[model samples]
Target: MPRFMGFVKMEEGIGAPPQALFDAMDKYIGEQSAQGHFLDGGGLFGTEDAVNFVVRKGETTRVDGPYAEAKEVVGGWALLQYDTLEEAIKGQEEFAELHATYWPECSMVATLRQVADEPPAPAEG
Candidate 1:
């Protein structure tokens, strides 16, 4: 089975979503969990309190967010596994549909990307 990393990208500072959407999402997540497609993941807080450690020029520097340039951020994520890409696409479609039906006012992107089986080489000092 191939693994996928699913992300929900939405504009920053939008405040909380509607209760109906949350209810629908709970149901959807429950179904996916029962079916074994939903792995480990959850929603995230806004970037106002986010932190980053950037590596540049052989040095790592810490940066805090509430970043001025950030337009969109990941609202939620999921680690999913499916037998094929078609199956994964179908799953993502159902998820997107739930959002479309329950949270029609929001603008967001639902991304499903295959995860690499192997990690990249370590960076040299």
Candidate 2:
């Protein structure tokens, strides 16, 4: 089975009541799980509270909040396990529909990858 990373971009100022958003997300996850396509998922805090880091010229720079954007920004995401890329895409589409109900401009993308048996190690010292 392949794993997919789903990045969900939300419309600006489409904030839902916290409880409503949580409830909808829970229902969405439950539906996906029942369909055997849900693996794990989480919602992140607003971009203003997120930390963004970058490495350049052998130096590390940390920035508060996500990079500047002209349009929508990622509000949350999920990881899905599926038998095929198509299946993962189907799941993403479903998620998009659910998000769209609250965020008309929400956008989603799914990237499929094979899960490795072990985590990769850092470069040798």
Candidate 3:
């Protein structure tokens, strides 16, 4: 089965409702993992916890955060395995429903991306 990454992006300072959702989500993940629908997932601290880096033309330039765009930060991610993208998408909808039900006031976006089974092949020498 292929894997997909489902992520949650949110602005900081929303407060307790998201934390409550996370608590519930943790239990949900454990149950899903037992049922073989979830592989792994976790919550992340705010963007203030990040150290940003910019790589341009192969030169790496690192910067300290508090990132300027709080809205651009990703709060957490989950990895799920499924036979098809549709199954992965439908699996993540449960989390979306949790958000809508519990954290309606928080600015949040949930996204999904398919994970490649292997890294790209190197070019021939």
Q: Residue by residue across 46-93, what tens digits does model 2's lDDT show?
A: 666778688999999988864467266665667778888787777777
Model 2 residue runs over 4 Å out of place are 17-24, 66-70, 102-125
The local distance difference test score of each candidate is 0.90, 0.67, 0.81
Q: Each prediction's TM-score against the native?
A: 0.90, 0.69, 0.85
Steric clash pairs (candidate 2): none
Q: How close to the true structure is residue 35 of candidate 1, measured as C-alpha lDDT? A: 83
Clashes of each: 0, 0, 0
| Backbone clashes in model 3, listed as residue pairs | none
Best by lDDT: 1
lDDT of 1 at 31: 87
Prediction 2 global C-alpha lDDT:
0.67
